[model samples]
Target: MILAVDIGTSSMKGGLITKEGYLFSYHRVRFPLESLKGDFSFSTELWSQGFLEILETLGASKVSVVAISGNGPTMVAANAQGKPLSPALMWNSDLGDSSIHSSSYYLSKINWLRENEPQLYEKSDLFLSCPEILYTQLTGRSVMVAPQEGYIPYIWSDSELERFHFRKSAFPEIVHMGSVVAPVSENAFLKTSLKPGIPVVACGSDFIASLIGSGAMKPGRICDRAGTSEGINYCASAAIGDSRVRELPHAVKGLVNISAILSSTGSLFEWYRQLTGQEKNNYKETMDGVNAVPASQGHPFFFPSMKGENLWEFKKGLFSGLEPGQGKFELGRSVMEAIGFAVRRSLEIFEELDLPVHELRVSGGQAKSPVWNQMKADITGKTMLIPEIEDAELLGCACLAATALGIYNSVSEASEDLVKIKHEIHPRKEFSDIYDIKYRRYRRACESVVSFYRDYPVSE
Candidate 1:
């Protein structure tokens, strides 16, 4: 068995998977992503504690190989002695200029650190993403696992790097995804009691791992993780060359992947629960109403705007068309409907790049809800492929490890052999027909909202 782990925005996850792709056991540890003023971050200490907790749960399994994947373009600054110098700049943190997208996001954040925290910046030894930072903890060696684009450790142009005054030395050595970074050190062995000298592979980012784990490696395939934020990722023949999508090199090597962000989806639901004093029973109670409500409720339209994506500017979340007698249930249904509509809207942008979305391989907290999944299918008019496992990201890391250990010829093949499709949810004709009318209304609502933001710029 190989141990595959990854650092997530809200938690750390991994498990032991057999060479053939069977996941034997798994574990997770959540860490606090604190907010300071308006910015968000999680420190290296929290991440380390999470990692060690996961290792402690694994109980010293003798693994053939070790690999890690993490979300990015998050920045983790480390001091010369390898201690964390600053809380990681999460992918969603706003660095004052909402103008900056993935093209120069990491550079901008690193620049912010250098300017705002010069003392910490000057003492910084490296700016590694979560994967490299976590792997370095295990091996006592550091190497930045390169992402194709959309993520940091990307192929940084010297001019672009200089534009942000990015510190070249602050970055770790670049290495290809799945490369054997180094052997595990004795110090790491003491923490977990695993044998020393195990080859550690620097698996790519978490988003790519989600694709592999869901078997969405081919072009037109999408791996959607509808959790805290909605991640809409699809494989493409080449870069769409559109800002609407964040492009990255695929784990398959030849193809590329384009990811779109919703900034809010599941989190919107959680926020509503908090507002309604239903935090403890949010899922069960809201889902009850979700099932009770049918397609095309024709209620209010909700716009989730907390985490703005590539195309739209950050604006306030809005709920329109409210009337008397429409209570929290209607609000809940509207949130669900809006989530579906927002997904379709994002896909329209993908289609503009000529990257037709074939199917959505979805996994996350939202994936457990058949009602929402059906709503998504009806709204998007595409089939939803739900994986057998809840942790596709962790499974994706397993695919990377399998590839690194020669267990599979490629990540694509590993996914095919191992990733099982539990069920496929197809679009229902009746629901689609109703959603057609509601979708048209949704389009108009979005246009109005965008126009409002344009006229009155919050300047986010």
Candidate 2:
């Protein structure tokens, strides 16, 4: 059996997968996000403890292989001995803001580290993601930093590393996802009830894994990831030449993956729920209420950038033209419409780049909403497909394990076998026509607000 673990934003999930592509037993444990003022982070120690507890409950004898998929773009600074210097800055955390975006910023932080916590930084050998950090903690061995496509220090080539004065020794050696990092150590055996020598495979980022798991193997196929943060990813034979598209690492060689992120999607709905004092019920009820209401003729534009935008602009959210007693359902519908519009805008960029987009595969928490799915289909004017597995990210990791175990010849072949289409949501002609207008309005709103946010200086 293969053990697949997904270290998510809010919780951790473990699944036991059989050789025949069957998911047997799954376990989920919730962990708290530590928010110290504006700095959001997660406790590495707590995560380690949680893993041990879950393994103990699973009974070590039942598991054979271990694979991990985790959130990305987040770095954990660690000492040469594999000890953490501080709480991990999660992918969602913006603690390093400018420092994360610029190499010069890192230099500044290094100076600050030297002044404030020099000893800790001195001991630190590398800044790695959760998977590398966890692997070191578990096996007392270091694994290489996987190449992430875009954002912060572009994938460091050998020359680029020299230019940046980065030490290769400080970075772990790169290993392909699903490659065995280390055998289960005596410490791991005592911490978890698992037997020794089980191979642990390092999985890729959740988004990349989800694309692989979604069976979007052929070029031009796109997947809409409507979770806490919305991501529209498409598989291409070649990397997008456009500046707007973010080129990311693909598990399969030669094929390139490009994505546009919304920075907020389900998060907007969550905010609406909290604002209306309806936090208890599922989002289905809220979406259902919106579906009952007619599409607003006025087409009140909404910019759904609740978590400071990406892809378009970095600004707080906005809802324009709110009349007194406009009804919460209208507001909710507007939010959904806004999200759909944002996706459409992203697709427009793909169109400009001449990227082929044939089918749309939808997944994540938002895929559960029929209303939202329909809206997305109409707005994009493409058939939206939902896979049999809701958590494509987890299944993607499992697919890698299947390949490593030789159950399938290749990642693409394993994806073809494991991914099954659940259903298709086709676009409604009338709804599509109406959404065309709303989408145009959304673009105009974005153009109007972008310059203001970018140029206007705010008082400190």
Candidate 3:
């Protein structure tokens, strides 16, 4: 059996999988509220606790290999012994630059530490990403996991390191995903109850793992890994150099992953529910209210963002076409519609770039909502594929472990063997036609916001 784990922002989820891809058991552990600080920082100890707790819940004797994935480019300054010197610098932490085009921004976190917490910075032996820190703790080896050579620039290029004036020694040796890092150390075994000889396989960032787990390994397949934020990962054969989309190497070698992120898909729904004083209402009730409001040409429209050409130029959300009788239900429907429209716009950008989206493999919390799933299908005019394992991140780790252990020839092959489609939602022509017109209006309203913002540019 393989022990697969994915470390998330607020929580960690893990599961056990057999060599044949059967999931034995799964568990999740969340960081205590007290450990998570308001400044987008959290104690790294929470990760160790979560790992041990998961192991406690799922006994480790039968586990042959361990594969772990985590969120990044979150940086953790650690000592020579793989002990954290301070709280982790989260992915959302302000590191002076908000750009994701390069890894210089992530290095800025280390710079911030040097300037603010000079003592800890000087004491640190290396700065590691979220998952690498945990791997170091388990295997007593400090290394970085870069999905491919192209991704090295997005992590730490030699030029970026020189430009930032940081010593290369502060960084770990770069390793590709699925490489056996090392055997679990005796110390880790004593602390976590696992044997010391288990091989620890590298599973890159959570998003990459989700891409593999969702079976988005082939060109034209897109993975909609939705959570608080949504990532539309479109796998392609060639890398695209476009500002509208970010391109990186796919988990499967020789493939490209062109992606865009909607920063507030699921979170926006929750935000609207809270703002409308429906906080007490359950998710089903809120979505039910949204479903009751019929989708029509006259339905209220909403624009959840006012982003311009620049990714950082996000302003206030706009709610257009509100009427006298319209209340929470209308507004709620508009929110859902806005989310759908946002997804369509992203796909349109991909289409323009010649990366045609064949279908969407939907995963995450929003995948549970059939109403939203159907709305996404109708709005995007693409099929929605719900995988048997909705938590594809954990499954992705399983794929990595399976590949590392020679259970499969490669991660893509492992994914093909393991991932099974549970349901498929096709677009309804009636709703698609209505949404096609609504989508045009949504674009126009977004253009209006851009023009308005240009005339009266926002102040930072």
The C-alpha stretches of model 1 lying farther than 4 A from their native spots are 33-41, 96-105, 147-169, 296-298, 305-314, 452-460
Give the Cα error of residue 230 in candidate 2, in Å. 2.4
Best by TM-score: 3
- Better structure of 1 and 2 per lDDT: 1
TM-score, every prediction = 0.87, 0.85, 0.90
Model 2 stretches with alpha carbons more than 4 Å out: 33-40, 52-61, 79-83, 95-116, 145-170, 296-299, 305-314, 448-460
Over 1-460, each residue of candidate 2 has an lDDT whose tens digit, in order, gives: 7777777666677778776666677777766523321143466665676677667666568888877777765566787656677766666654452433343223333333445565765677876676676677667677753523332243334554465455566666666666668877776412566667887777757777788778877788887876667788888888767776777655567777788877767666767787877777777788788888787455356665432335223246677888876777878877778777778878878888888665688877777677888888898898889887767776787888787778888878988899888899999999888878777776766777666666774433
lDDT of 1 by residue, 1-460 (tens): 7888877766778788777667788887765525322254566677777767777787556577888888777787786445677777887677634433436446677777777788887878877777777677778777777643434435355567666666777766667776688888887522555678888888857777777888888877888876567778888888767776777677777788788877667666777787777777847667887677655555777776533332222247778889997777788888778778778888888887777876899987678788778888999999998887757877887777777778888767888888988899999999888888888877766777777877787654
Considering TM-score, where higher is better, how would the candidates rank from best to worst? 3, 1, 2
In TM-score terms, candidate 2 sits at: 0.85
Candidate 2 minimal-lDDT segment of 10 residues: 147-156
lDDT of 3 at 119: 88
Name the lDDT value of residue 422 in candidate 1: 88
| Residue 67 error, candidate 3, Å | 1.2
Query: All models: lDDT?
Result: 0.73, 0.69, 0.82
